[model samples]
Target: MAARLTRWAIFSVAVSLIPLIFSFIYLTTVGPTPAFFDLISDGELLLISVALTGAAIGEVIDKKTARIKSRLASGGGCFLVASLSSSYFVVVSAQDDVRKEIVMGMSCALLLLGVISAGLAMAASEGEEGG
Candidate 1:
């Protein structure tokens, strides 16, 4: 189950890149369209966010102390970065200041959660190893 989850996570990450690559190709051939590019970038980032989240969840489910610690740390970190990037794009594209602020706040909260999860996973792993 763990291996399968890891494979799926990897596949999700790879698929997420497809939109950005296609968007680049479309831009090169058809010239620039900010709206279209923004749409594609946003979708790509969201996909990446989901992928990282899946990876982190998978690591937690696996529950192998040492492995879980490293995987959770890396996966959570990646998720946090992706969430921040998504929030930035959301802010840039959103017209309403109120909505933009709300989204940004939520994104920051998610990042904090990711950091906390990573730290806890590490501590749990250490406890398992030492006790």
Candidate 2:
């Protein structure tokens, strides 16, 4: 689970950061634009990705002590928080309509992932109790 989550976190980090980096560079080189504002506003997602990746790293390094179900539950909760933040960005950021729609879709995807992770944690807990 730790490995899997770490992979997921890494992928998400790439997804969030790659565009951010390119956009930031473009903003710096080209001048002020809506993309720059979008980058500034959407920056929190990078932090969230880093934090979740850190949590996964901790689990991987401390495998002997970390509880799998708890880790999954917490990871799921973090995802929910991130999803909420993204949703807020969609509503608050004055980004273009197309980008706003993209953010909305990302929020929904995050919400789905959170629910799935939470469900997996619950299933794991049940298995532990039953056996």
Candidate 3:
């Protein structure tokens, strides 16, 4: 049970991060945009990483992934916070409109990722105690 839960938590991370990573790559390097490396490895990614860590903690801490997931099953603003911040940067910093959308979209995806992250953490924590 614990192992299954851990698998799910990791699966969640992989599942969520895939869009983020891909969109991030696509958005920042679709055209004659600035440096792709620069955009992808900037503050936005850093924020996502940190926030995801927190979210992961939240999920596993409760000793039951299902429990945390249940609480956040039908929630809002999953990626709104991250998207807003990322959008701001994308609009202001990204000159190309296409790239901007990609960046913004990536942020939005990451926002969702952040939301699920907490649940993952809670689930992991629950599994730790053999719950």
At residue 67, candidate 3 shows an lDDT of: 51
Stretches of model 2 off by over 4 angstroms after superposition: 32-38, 42-83, 94-131
| Model 2: lDDT to the true structure | 0.49
How does model 2 score by TM-score?
0.36
Among the numbered candidates, top TM-score falls to: 1
Q: State how far residue 93 of model 2 sits from its true place (Å).
A: 2.9
Each model's C-alpha lDDT? 0.50, 0.49, 0.51
RMSD of 2: 9.9
For model 2, how does the per-residue alpha-carbon lDDT over 1-131 read when each residue is reduced to its tens digit? 45544555466544545766876787778875544346544434534443443444343334434466665665555555545655565564555544654664554455455434433433233323221
Candidate 1 lDDT over 57-90, as tens digits, reads: 5555566556655656655665565566566556
Clashes counted in candidate 3 amount to 19
Query: Against the hidden true structure, what lDDT does model 3 obtain?
Result: 0.51
Error of 3 at 123 (Å): 8.8
Task: Name the 10 consecutive residues with the lowest summed lDDT in model 2.
Answer: 122-131
lDDT of 3 by residue, 61-129 (tens): 443434555435422233344445556555545554345446556655565565554444444345334
In model 1, which regions exceed 4 Å deviation? Answer: 1-15, 33-43, 66-131
How far is each candidate from the true structure, as Cα RMSD in Å? 8.4, 9.9, 8.6
